[model samples]
Target: MAAIPTSNASLKDALLRPGFTPTSPAATRLSDPIADTPLVLTLDDVLPYDANPRTTQNPKYDEIKESIRQRGLDAPPPVTRRPGEEKYRIRNGGNTRLSILKELYQETGDDRYYRFHCLFRPWDAARGEIIVLTGHLAENDLKGDLKFIERAIAVEKARTLYEAEAGKAVSQRELASRLSADGYPVSQSHISKMLDTIQHLLPAIPGLLYSGLGVDRISKILALRKTASACWDKHYQGEGVEFEMLFQDVLSQFEGDAEEFFFDRFQDELVGQMKKPLALGYEDVLLEITQQQRELRRSMPIVDAPSLPAPPAAAPAPDTSLPDDTAPGDAPPQQPPELPEPPARLAQQTGSQVQLPVTPPAGDQMSDEERQARIDGHVVSPANISPRVVETKRKVAAALGETLPDFNSNALIAIPVQAGSLHPISDLWYIEHDIDTPEHLREHIAQLAFEITQSVNAPGEIIPVDGGIGFSYKQPADEVDITETAHHTLTLLQSLSGATAIALKMLGEQPAPAAMDALGEFQFAAGLGQILLGQPTARDQAPDDSGRLSDGALVKLFRIVRLARRLIDLEIQEYATNTSELNG
Candidate 1:
C-alpha cells in the first residue's frame, strides 16, 4: 500500500492537480481543461464542511452506511480548498456521507472505506465564503433535510457574511436578491420571519425550535409574543416584572421535542400568565392573538390557481324528419321551428276584468341596489326595510352617532332626553347597570370597569356606555349632529370618570388593593380616567371601517376588566374580614 501524505504542503506537491497537463487519452479528449479531477485519498485527508446547514445526523444514516459498506462509494463528493488552506472540504454537500464513511472505516478497518474517490475543484477567493455557504444551503434544500431552525441560523450567518462583503448593513430585500443570484432563492418575507425566529424565539425555546419546529408554528409563536407583549406594556405599572422574562419562564415549561410541543397548550399557558401582569382574561389575550393572525393572513399575497381548459361542447341532436322534395337518400338540413306568439290576454275580451301580475311587498322584494338606495336616503326604520338593511344602517348610525328620521313617519327615533334610569341603547352595545343585590352590583361594576379599559384602548367608531348613549373615537369627515344617545353616553362617561377619581382618593386611605402598590393604585385610577375620557385609541391609528370594536381592542378591554374584578374582589374580602373582627 502507498503511504498517505501527512501535511498540506506534501498533499499539494504530490497530488496530480486537475489543471496539470493531461497525458491519458480520456483527459486529453476533455472539452474543458479545468474540469474537476477525481483523486483517491484517505478519509483523514479530506474534511467535512464546517458550515453545513444540516446540524443533526442524517435520518438515513444506517441505510446509507449499509449501502456504502456493501457496494462502496458510488459517487465522489466535490471538494475544494480555500486559499492558504491545506485541507479540502465539501464544495456543496455530502457531509453526512463523509461522516458515514469515517464510521465505516473505524468499525471494519476496511481499506475501501478508508481510501475513497473525491472530485477536486479550485476555490475562488473573489467569490468568498458566501458562495460556499449558499451552496450548502441549496444542496440541503434539495434534499429537504435541514430543520427550520437550522435554515434560519444558516440564513442569518449568510446575512453576516453578505454584510461583511458589502462593508455596510444590508436590507433583507438585498440579502434575498443576493441569495437568489447565488443559486439559493429565499423570499424577503421569509427572511424577515427567519430573523424574527432567531432573535426572539431561539433564546427562549431553543429546544423546541432546534428539535424541528416548523416555519408555520414559529410564525404563530412570534405573532403571539408581539400581541401579548403589547398587552403587558399597556397594563404594567413599572412593577418589577418584564415581558421577556415572563415569556421565558412560561416557555421553559413546554420545552422538549418539537413534535410533542403543542402550540395551543403553550399559547394558553403563556396567556394565562400574562393575565396577572396585563390585567387581562384568557379570552382577551386570545382575542389579540386572533386579530394578529387575521392581519397576517390578510397581508399575505394570494396566488391564483392555474385555469383549466373547458371540455368540448356536445354535438347537436340528429334530425330524423325526411325532406319532402328530394330523393329518398337526399335530405335538406333541418331548421329550428320558431314559436307562435301568445294568445290575446283574457282582460282584452269584452266585459272582462283587467288582471295584473301579483307581486310581493316592495320591502320584501327589494334588491340589494334598492336597499342600498334606502340606506343612502337614511331610511333605516326596521318596520319599512329588510333586517339586513336595517342592520347595515344601524352600524352606520351607531358609528357616526347620528339619529335618523323614521322612514315612514319622517319623525326622529325616540331617544332618552334626560339621563334617568339606566336603559339598553338601541342599535348599540351597552353595559347592564340594574342589580338587585350588592353581590350582583359588584359584579356589574367590575364588568363596567373592564369595558372601560376596552373603550379607551379599542379601535372603531362606537363607544357604548350607560343610558342608550355612544361616542365615536374617530373624527368625522364632516360636522356630525350629536344625537341624544351620543350626548347621554358622553355625559355618563364624564360622570363615571369624576366618580372614579373620588373613589380612588377614598380608597387611598385604606390598604392598597391586592396585587397593587402605590404606583399600581395611581395607574389604575389613571387608566380608568383615560377610558372614561375616551383618550386612548387602538395602537394602529388607521381607521377601522368595520364600525365595530376590533378583536384586539376587545381583548385589551377584557384584560383591564379582569384586573379590575380582581381588585374589587380583594377590596370586598378585606371589608368582610374587618366587619367579622369588629363583631367578634
Candidate 2:
C-alpha cells in the first residue's frame, strides 16, 4: 500500500519524511529493526544477484510464470541494499517472478507490474554469501518445487558458500542440519546423493542438464553413476574424452529434441548393457573406441618433417646499404613461402558401442583428477546411505536374489519407471471401505478367477533372437520382467483361485474358518502376483519386456488375480456377519 521513491536522493527524503509507527509489544527479541519495513522501488532498480544459488526450469517454470501473470506476487523478493548505491540486489527468492514481470512489461507496457517490493537488508561481503545462499536454499526447499538437479546445484552451492564463510569444510550431515534449522528439512544422506548427481554424473554429460531433463531423470542415471564412472576411468583412463562428444553420441541415437525421450532411450540402452553377463556396458563400449584412438595416435609421428628446407645462409655483413634490388622508399620485397596444411582429424570408427569423437582441442579437455573429483562428489558414501536408497536396495536384492554391488536401489526402480516400464503401486490403490452382499462378491471373484486361470494356461512363449530368446507376450517390454518366480507365481495364483472361489461361495451361505483361511491366502497370492507383473527385468534385451499390467493394477488377468480373491473374501465375511445377527 505504501509508495516509494524512484532515486537515491528521493529515497533518502522518503525515509526521512516517513510517518513511522512504534514496534508492537509482540515483537520478538531477535527481530531485526531493519527487516521490519520492506523497501519499494521500480523493478528497474532491482538487479538479480547472479550468484544466488537456485534454478528452476519449465514446463514447471511455465506454470509459475503463468500463475504470477494471472495472480501477481504472493511473496515479495528479498534484496540487499549497498551502503551508498541507489540500486538493490535481489539476494534470494523471486527470480522467476522478476523474469515474468519483465516479460509482461515488455509485452503489455504495463507500469504497475514494473515495480518491485522487497525486504531490504544490510549486506556484509563475507557473511552475505552465507545469508544469500541459505536464503535461496530455504526458499526453494520450502516451496518443494526445485527439480533434482536444481536442488543438487543449490545444495552444492550452500556447502561451498558456508565453507567459504566459516573458513572450514563442514560435514554433509552438519550442512544438512544447518539447512534444516534455516527451514528446509532435508537429510544428510539425501544431500550426499544430490551432491554425487550434481558433482559427478552431470559433469560427465554436460548437455544432459540443459536438454530439458529434470531431476527425476538425472537421479535415475546417477544410480548408475558409479558404474559409469568406473567404466569411464577404465576406458578413457584420462579425461581425454569430452562430455560433449558422449552427449552428442547419445543425441544422435534418438530422433527429435525432446530430451526426456532421448534420455529414456539412452537409459534403456545403458540398462540393457548393464544386464549383460559379460558386457562392460557403457564403459566397455566407449573403451573400445579409446583403444582404436591409441592405435592411431601411435601410428602418426608427433611432429612431421618439413616439405622443403632452405639452403644454408651466410651471415649478413654490417650494413648501412640497402639491397640493390630495392629503391630508398620502396617496400622491402620478399616472397612468402607456401606452408603445408595440417593433417586432417581422424574419422570416428563405426560400431554399435558409442564412439567418443576424436579428442577435442586442448582447451576443452578436463584433467583426470578434475573429472574424478566431480564423480566422487556424487558417489553415495557407503558409510551414510539414505533410507530410500537402503530400502530400494533391500527390495531389489530380495526380488532379484543378487546384490547390485555399487548400484543404488532408487535408480534401479526409478529408471524403469521413468522409461514407462515399471509403475508404482499407488496407481492401483482403491478405497473400498465397505461392500454390500456376499453373493455379489462371489460372482466378481469367480469372474476374476476365470480370467487369471485363462492367462496362466495361455502360451507365454519366447521367440529366439540374435543373442537370447525374447518373450512373445503381447505386453510391451517395459511392463514386466520374465523371472522364474513370476512364472511360478502365476501358476500358484491359478491354483489358489479355486480356494478363493470356494471361500466366496461359502461366505454367501455361512461363514467358517475354512473360508477365512482361503480368504487370508488371497493376500499373499495377490502380493506376489503384483510383484510378478510389476517387477523390472534383469536385462533390457527384448522389445516386449513390459508385462500386460503395471505393478499396481487391480482386477486384471495378468496383474491382480489375487486382489480379486481378497475383495471377494471381504464381502463374504460382511454378509455372513449380517445374516448371523438377523437370525439372533
Candidate 3:
C-alpha cells in the first residue's frame, strides 16, 4: 500500500479522553521493536492460518468462524514474537480482530459496519505489541502499595506478568483464579498481565518514584482497595492487625477527616466491622458507623428536649352537645367528671375533667386506629365475654373486631444459666425493649421472657427472633449518668413489663442507671456507665484454684468449725419439726 496519510494509528480505535486522537501515530507505536504482520494477512485471512495451536481447538473458535462467515472481520487482532524468531510473530492481535468482526457480523448481519484495530509490530520486533496492549490497562484499577502505593501496584502487576511468562504453563484462567482466591478478583487484563504482562505503565507522578514524593494519583486498586490503605503512601501492619485492619484504622481517621470521599470508602467502612465476622480491634469503628448511620437516617429518637404532658387520648374530639350527665339531671349525690388519667395517673392531672381513652402510652404520637387497637388489646378476643365485663369491654371489642393487638414494644429477656453453663450466679434474665408500651406488658413480657429463655415457664409467648425478651445487659458504665433518659426509660418501667422492670432493676443498682430523665436524654452523664453494662460470665469468678476448688479452703479453720456446728443444729431442728408433723 502507498504511504497512507494515516500510516500509523491505534488499531482498536477505542474512545479517547481529552487531548487524544484515534488515528494518531502515537497510538500504535511499538514499545519494543520486532514486527511482521503474519506474512501478508487481512481480516479474511485470519481464520485459516490455525497457527495459534494453544487455542486452535478453543470452543470460541467455532463461534469466530461462524462470525466470519456472516460478516467480514472488523478489526485486526494483537500479535507477539514467534518462539525464537525476531519477526513473523502471531501472538494475538490480528486474530482477536477477526474474532470480534466475526461475532459482530453475526450479531448485526452487517459486517461492513464493524471496525477493529491492529498492534502491528516492527518487521524486526514486538515493541508495537507491547505498547498497544498496555493501553488495555486503564490506571484506575489497582490497590495502593504499602509505601508508594501506586508504584507498588504497578510493580506487583509487572512482576506477576514476568513470572507467568517465565512459566510456560501459565494461562489467563490461572491468573484469574489466583486473584479471586486472594480475595482480589482478576479480570481479562489482570489475567493477561499475569500470563504475558505485555502492557506497561510509565511513571504517572513526575518525581514520585525517585524523589520520594507522594504517590498522589492512585490507580488500578479496584478489588484490592478494601484490604487496606497506606498513609504517606505507606502500608503498615501493627503487632496483631490483619491485612484489612491496617487499612481500616486509617480509614477511621479519614471518616470525619475526609474532605473528598473515594470509592474505596465502602471497603474501609466494612473492615473490622463489630458484629458479623466480629473483630475486637475495630469495635470502635463499628460504633462510629452506627452513630454515623443514626445521623444520616434521622432515625435516632431525640430524648433531651422538654415535652408537655401529652393529653390523654382525646375523647373523640368532644361530641356537639353536652351529655345529660353534664346537664341538669335529677341530682342524687353528684358523681365527679371522668379524668383522662391513666388509672394510676388519675391523681396527677388537676382541673382537667377530660374523657381519656385508657390507651396506654398515650403520650406518644399515634394514629387513631393504632390507639384504638392498643386500647382494645386483644387482636382476637373471646366473642362470649361471660357477661361480667360486658359494660366495660363490649364497646372496645366491637370497635376492634377481630384485630387482637398485643403490646407494640418487643421484649427481650435473658434467662440466666446454671453454674458451669453460660451464666451461673443468677437464674434471672437480661433484656431489651424495641417498641413503646405500658406497664401491663411487664408481667406478660416477663412470663414470655421466661418461656422463651427455656429457664422456666408454662407456654409463654414466643418472641419473633430466636432470643427472648431482649434486655440490654450491655448497658452504660456504672458511672455513666443515665438519669437524663429516665423518663422515657421510666415510662418503660411502668411496672407493667417484667422485661423493663428487670432491665431497670439491674440499672437501678448502679449509681446512675439507664433511666432517662423525663425525656429520653441522659440526666446525668458518666465516664463509666457502659463499662458496667457488659455482664460478668461464670469464667470470671475467682476460682478456688484456677477452678481447682478444695474442701480445705472452706472447712479447715475455726470459723468453718462454728459454721459446721450451726449446720448440725439446724438439721436437728428440721428433723424434729418433720417428726412432729409425721406424728400428727
Candidate 4:
C-alpha cells in the first residue's frame, strides 16, 4: 500500500521513531544474559514459513543461528497477539525463525538464547517487540509489500516446499505444512488456491493481467475462473455477440485502463481468446448446436404443390386427368418392354451402389510417384467393406479406357475390400502401365510376376495373395529359375552402361534369338567378364584347364553370381552412402 516517500531518510533514521525503536525485557541481565550459552526452542513454541509473498526465505538461517549461538541474539522476532486470543501469533515474520531455534535446541539442548534479558535499558525504546497473538509472532515491517507477479511466484515457491517436505502429492494440508516450514502467516486453503490460480487461469488470460495487479486479487480471479470468462465470449468480429459479451464488458470496467498502455495487453485476454478460438470441453457445445439445427429444420413450414397444367395442348391431357398409374397397363404411354430375369452366376458382384467415392484424397495434390506408389504397394482384402472403393475402381477403369458393363448388385461382391490403410507399396497393389510393344509388354508382365512372388514368398514360409495357396520352399518360383533371370537382367543393364563397342562384343558372342532369355544371356556374359578379371577368386584355382566351367574357368562362380545380381546402381550407391554419413 506504500510507495516512495516524499521525504528521504536512511533506514536507520526511520528506526529512531518512537514506536519503531528497540527494547529489551528487564527479566534478565544484559552483559552476560545467556549465562554463556544460547537456547534452542522446540515445536512446543512455533514452526517456520514465509509470512508474505513479497519476502523470501532466508536460506542462511542455520548460519545465522550458529552466529547467534557463538555471539548472542542480535534481533528478536516481531510478534502480535490474535485479536481475541490469549496465545500469541506472528503477524509480519514467519515461524521459520522459531523452527530454526527449535532445531538448534533439539541438536545441542542449549537454551541460552531464551534465558537472556535486558535490565532497564530504555523507558520505551524497542527495536521490534515479540508480541505473540494466538500463540504466534507478528512481523510487520516498514518495507512495502510485493507486486502481484511477485506474490504469484512466492505462492509457487510455497507449493514446491509443501510438496518436497511431504514427499507426496500436495493438498491443502501440505499447504499448511509449507506455511510452517517457510515462515508464512497464512491459512491452508488460502495458500492452496493461490498456487492453483496461477497455473490454470493466468495462462488462459493472455497478457491481460500481467500489469502488476495485487496477488490476492489475481488469486481470487484465478480461483473463481471459468471457461466462460475467456475468448469464446468475444463478439467474433462483431458478427454476432455471445450472451457473455455483456458480462465481459461489465468486468472490463472493473479491470480499468490496463489497455491504456498497449491497449492490446489489457485486451490481450480477449485477443488471445479470439486468435486461439477455444471452447473448453468440446462435446457439450457441439451437441447443443446440432440439436438446435435439427430443431430449426423441424420447425420449417410445409407448402402445397401448384396445380398441373392441362396436357391437351401438348398432346392429350394425360389420361384426361386420371389418377396415377397402379400398373404398367394403366400408364401404357410411358411403359417399356420387360426383360427376362438375370442369371444367378451373373448376379454375384456388380452394382450401381458401387459408385460411392471413399478415401477422399485430392488427385492433383499428390505427385505421380506417390499415386503410383499407392497402386503398387497397397492391399485390398475380400473381407474389407470399402464404402467407396467401387467408385475408386470405376475411376481407375475410366483412366485405363476400359469398358464398364451395367452393374448388377451381385457383381459388387467380386471387388476387393479395405484390409487396412493403403501403404502404397504392398505386393498386391494394382498394376498400371502404358503398353507400347510386345517386348515392353512382356517385360512388364515378367517384372510384375517376379515382384509379386518375391514380396509374398520367402525361402520357407509364404503368405498367398489369395488368402491361401502358395509354393513350398523346395519349389522354384513356379518351376522357373526366377533368381537366375533376375540376376541376368541386372547384369545386362550393367553391360549396357559401358562403351557401345563393348556391347557389340556381347552380340558377336551370341544372337538375341539364340539366347534363351535376354536377361539370362546378359548374366552369362557378365559372369564371363568377372572370371576373366579374376575379380571373384576361386577357393582353390587350377593353373590350367579345358575351361568348360572347370576349376580354372569358373573362378568363384557363387561370388560372380552375387556380383551379377546387383540391385543398386553406382550413382544410387553413392547417394545412399552420402545420406548414411549425414545421418550418422
Candidate 5:
C-alpha cells in the first residue's frame, strides 16, 4: 500500500480523475458532531430513520398535537448525525412531534413551530442497531403507544442484531429478557403470541394489528388461526377453505366488534356458515330435548299400582273345610288342586315399541310385498298418521266435541295437540319445533305470519295484513279494514304465546290453579270475536270500489286469515275449558 497525497488540491484532482484511485483510509470517521449541547434545528434538517420500529402515524397523534399546542414541547427528540451527511435522522423518538410541528407550521406559518429541539448523538453503524432499538423500546414503553405489530418488529430487530453479533439464534426467554432490559418488559408467552400475530396474521391482513387489537385479542386471533388451520386440515384434507380466508371472513363479520368477539362465538358462527362435516352433530338440540324430557317426567308423577279386588268373602268354617276326603289328624289323601297361576303382566319399556305382524287368515295366500304393505298400513294410515295418533285425536274429539276445529284445515290444532300430549303424535314434534320454551313457539308464529302474508292469493279469502302484520298501503279501504282486523287477531296469537309461556313458568312457582287462571286470562283476551271468517262474509263486507289484490296475494292472505282465525278460536276454547275447570 502507498500513502495518499496530503495536499487538498492534489487529493481533489485525484478523486475527480476518472481512472485515478487512492488507498483506503485506516479508519472511517464515525460521525460529524453538529452540536456539543442540546440544539434547535429546522424541521428540514431532521429526517426519519429508514428502519424505525415505531410507525409513522401515531394513535395518540391528536393528543400529542393538542398537548404541544397547550404547553410547549417538554422533551427534545433524540437524533444522530448521519456518518457523513448534513441532515440528522431520529435515532428513536419524536416522529409524532415532528409530524405535529410540520402540520402546525403548515397551518399557522409560525417560525417557532417550524423549528424543533433535538439531542444529537454520534453513531457507529457496526453497533448502531441495538443502540437505536434500545432507545426506540424505551420511548415506546414510556408512551405505551406501540401496537403489537410494532413490538414484534422491535423484537425481531433485536433478535437479528443479537444473532448477528453472537452468531446463533436466540431463545424466546433470552430475547424477552433482553427486551425487558430495554424497557419493553414482555413475557415469553406474550412475545410468542405477538410474533405469531406478526408472522401469520399481519402478512395476510396488513394493518390489522393497528386496528385496536390488544394482546388478548391477538391471542384469540392466534388461537382462531390454530383452530381454523386444524379444522381445515381435518375436514378438507388441508384444502378448500384457507385459514386466512376464514379469518378475513370472521374479521368482516364482526368488523366493529372483532376485538371483543372471542373464539367460542366466532367458532359457532363459523361452523354454521361453513357446515364442516364431522363425526358428531351439534349437541344443543339433544341437550335441550333431554332437559325437556326430564321436566316432563317431573311434572307427571307415577301412579301407584291399583289394589287388587278383594277375593269373594270366605264362606263359613263348614263350607271352607280344606278337604273332605281324609279324617281328622290324618293327612289329606289328596291335596286340593292348586289354583292356576295367573300369567305375568308384561311391563312397558322406556323407548320404542316393536309390534309383531298380524297372522293372515287361514289358507290365505299373500306375497311378501303385500304382507309388507299390510304391515305398513296397519302401523300408519293413508293419511300418514299412526293408529295411536288417530286414537288420541278420537279421544280428544270425543271430549271436546264441536269445540275442536277440523284437524285437516286447522294448523292451530297442532299446537294444542302437541301441548296436551294425551296421546302424543310423536316424540318428533318437541325436537322439530324446538319447543323448549314459549319463546321458541312464538318465534315460529312470527315466521309463520311472514310466510302466510307472503302467500296471499284470493279476493274473497280474508288475509291478515295490518296491525302487527305491519303492511304498508297507499290508501285505506274496506279490505284494508278487514285486513287490519285479521292483523289484530294475529297479534293476539303472538301475545297468547307469551301468555302461555308465562303460565308454564308460573307452574314452577305458583299452584296449578293460579297458573291456569293466568293462561285463561291470556286466552280470554285473545278471544274477542268470531275468529273464522266465511268467504261470503269476506266478499259482502268488502266495498265494491276497494282495490282487489292479485289472486296469488289473496291465496297467501287466505292462508294467513284461516290460520289466524283458527288460532283465535282455539284460544277461546282453551280459555273456556280452563276457566270452567277452575270454577268447578
Candidate 6:
C-alpha cells in the first residue's frame, strides 16, 4: 500500500532513498531525465499484451529463462496501462521474457523473478490501439523471428483497427501508408501478397503457414493456386466440384512440414485431380497452368532492386610490365597464362550429346557369387512375351509362309524365328521413315486444332500469329470497297476448303461434297471457330430475336472447322514430304 512515484525525479529519488543497488550497467545509465524510471513490480501487477504478433513461445525460451535466473533481466520491458484500465500490459514486446519470469517464479519460489523491474509508459487514448499494435510489429520485426502467418494476421488486425477508426474501408495502399507512418513500414505489394495468403491459404494450410512458411514460398503458393483455379474454371463443367475444395484436399497431404513440402509435387497432384473433371490430359493441363502462371507474373507489380555499393576501384594494376628494370631480353617473367574459369555445370545439355557418368548399382557392392546367384534366380519364359507380340508373330508367319530366320544364330540347324523380327516389314518401314499412321495423323490434327483454338483471339481483334505478326478481319470502309473485303474473305475460305479436300483425298477418304461445301461457308467456319475458342462472334452476340446462330448450327460448324484443320495439316505434311524427297 505504497504510492508509486509518477515523475522520473521522484522515482529515481525513491530508488536511492530505499538504498536500492542497481542490478546491472543498464541501471547506472539513467542520466537522461526523459527516460522512464524502472519500477519494482510483482507478477500480479502486469498483464501480457493479448495482441502480441508472436503467437508461439520464443525458440530460445529455455536459454533466455536460464539467463534471467542466473544474471537477472538486463533490459526491463516497457509496460503501459490504457486509460481507465488498472492492469499494465506490454507496450511493444517482451511477452516471452515476462512469461519466463512467471515460470521461473513458480518453479524456484524466487522473489527476484516475481519482483522484477519494468519501465512504465503512459498510454494515450487519443493515439489509439493502432500505435500499440504497430509497436509490437516493429519490435517483433526487429527480432526477425516472427512467422509469416503471424505477421500477416497482425497486419490484418491492424488494418481492421484502422478501418474501425476511420469508419470506412481502407485500400491496401492507404493501409500500407498508414502502417509506415505509424512505424511498421510494409510495401503495398507486400500487403497485397500477405492478404492473399491470409484469405486463400490460411484456411487450408494453417499448420504449414504457422510452421514458418516464408514470404517467398507463400507468394509462390498463392500464384500456383491462382493459376490452377483459372485453368480449372476454363474446363470444369460439373455442378458440385469447386476448385478451392480440390486445392485444399491436395494441400492437406503436404501439411506435414513447410520446409519439406515440395511445391512441384503439390502442383502435380492438384493438376492430376483436375485432369478428369477438366477433361484434359495431364500435359495439357500443365501447359494451361504454365500459361496462367506467366500471365500472373506479368501482372504482378515490379519491385525495385536494392542498391549495391560500387566495387572498390581496382588498385592501379601494379605496373606489372617489367617495372622499368634494365634487363632488355628477360621477357618480363611471363606470369603463367591465367587459366580460364571452368564452365558452370549445365542444368540440361541440349543439341549436343553429353556423356553421363554411370554409377554401379548396389549389386556391385555384393560378392561375385551373390550377384551371380541373384541373376540366376530370374528366368525369362514364354509368359513374359506380351500377347501382342505373339499375335504379331502369328500374323507374320501366316503372311511369310515360314518363320523369319535369325542370322545371328550360327548353329547348323533349322533357324528359329527371332522375337524382334516379328514386327511386320511394312510397319517397320513406316516407323523408320517417320510416317504417321492414320490414327497418329488424326491425333496430331486434333492437338493442333485445340492449340489453335486456344491461341486465336475473338473476331475483329488483332490476333497474333506466327513470326510475331497479327491478323484481323478487315472491315470495309467505303461504299466502293464494301464488297471487296467480303469477296477476298470468301475466296480465302474457298481455298482453305479446297486444300482440305486435297488432304482428304491423300488419306484415301473421298471428301463428301456436302461437308466441303459446309466448310467453305464463311458464316459456319468463322462463327463456330469463334464459339469453340470461347470468343463470341458478332452474330452470336446479336439479340436473340436477331437470328443468332443456333446451338445445332454452332455444333455443325465446329465439326466442319475440325475436319478442315485436319485435312489442311495432312496436305501441308504431304507437301513437305514431297519437297524433301525431291531435294534428296
The top-ranked prediction according to TM-score is 1
Q: List, residue by residue over 1-584, the lDDT tens digit for candidate 3.
A: 68645423453343343564568455432344444443333344334223221222233556656665566443445544433443334343344445555566567766352433445444324233222233222212321121333323443453355355456544555644544443344444333322221122122222322222222222222223322222212323234545344444433443321234353464445444322233334634433443333233232122221233554574223322222112112233233465221121111211211221222333244333233323223111113333454344445544633212113221001111212121111111111121112232232333332322232111223232222222212233354443322322222222222455565677666655344442236421221221112223447653221111111211111122222233344456777989999999
Model 1 worst lDDT run, 10 consecutive residues: 411-420
Q: How many residue pairs clash (N, CA or C atoms closer than 3 angstroms) in each of the candidate models, in the order given?
A: 4, 12, 80, 65, 15, 0
Worst 10 residues of 3 by lDDT: 410-419
Model 4: CA > 4 A from native: 1-143, 177-189, 200-211, 216-225, 229-584
Tell me the TM-score of each prediction against the true structure: 0.48, 0.43, 0.22, 0.21, 0.40, 0.47
- Candidate 2 overall lDDT versus native: 0.49
Local accuracy of candidate 5 as per-residue lDDT tens digits, 1-584? 99875999888988888984678765644346645457788989898776767763677889999998878788888888656667888788777787788889899998888886878777866777677777777786578477767778778778888788778999888987877775566667666776787677675555446665666566646655555455545555434656567666665565443356554665566555544433334443222332333343233222222333333344224323322112224543433355322211112211221111111121124323232222222121123457686677557645632122232312111111111111122211112212322333333344444443333321232223333322212222445434543443443344433443554676769887887775666544433333332223354564231222322233333433433443454456777989999999
Model 2, which residues run further than 4 Å from truth? 1-40, 54-76, 82-86, 100-118, 140-144, 204-218, 224-259, 262-267, 275-584
Model 6 misses residue 441 by how many Å?
42
Stretches off by above 4 angstroms in model 5 are: 1-31, 34-36, 227-265, 273-584
Q: Residue 290 deviation, candidate 4, in Å?
A: 23
For model 2, what is the alpha-carbon lDDT of residue 377?
31
TM-score of model 5 (CA atoms): 0.40
Ranking by TM-score: 1, 6, 2, 5, 3, 4
> What lDDT tens digits, residue by residue, belong to model 4 across residues 41-141?
33443323224443433445567668776776556553333333333333445444555566676777776633432221111122112112111221322
Per-candidate local distance difference test: 0.58, 0.49, 0.33, 0.37, 0.51, 0.58
TM-score-superior candidate, 1 or 5: 1
Cα lDDT tens digits for candidate 1, 349-416: 11111121111122333333233222323211122345786577557654644333233221111111
Per-residue error for 21 in candidate 2, Å, reads: 42
Which parts of model 3 have CA positions greater than 4 angstroms off? 1-39, 42-67, 78-120, 123-132, 136-285, 288-584
- The deviation in Å at residue 266 for candidate 5 is 3.0
Better of 3 and 5 by TM-score: 5
Clashing pairs in 6: none
Per-residue lDDT of candidate 6, residues 195-239 (tens digit): 998888887788888888887677668878888888888888888
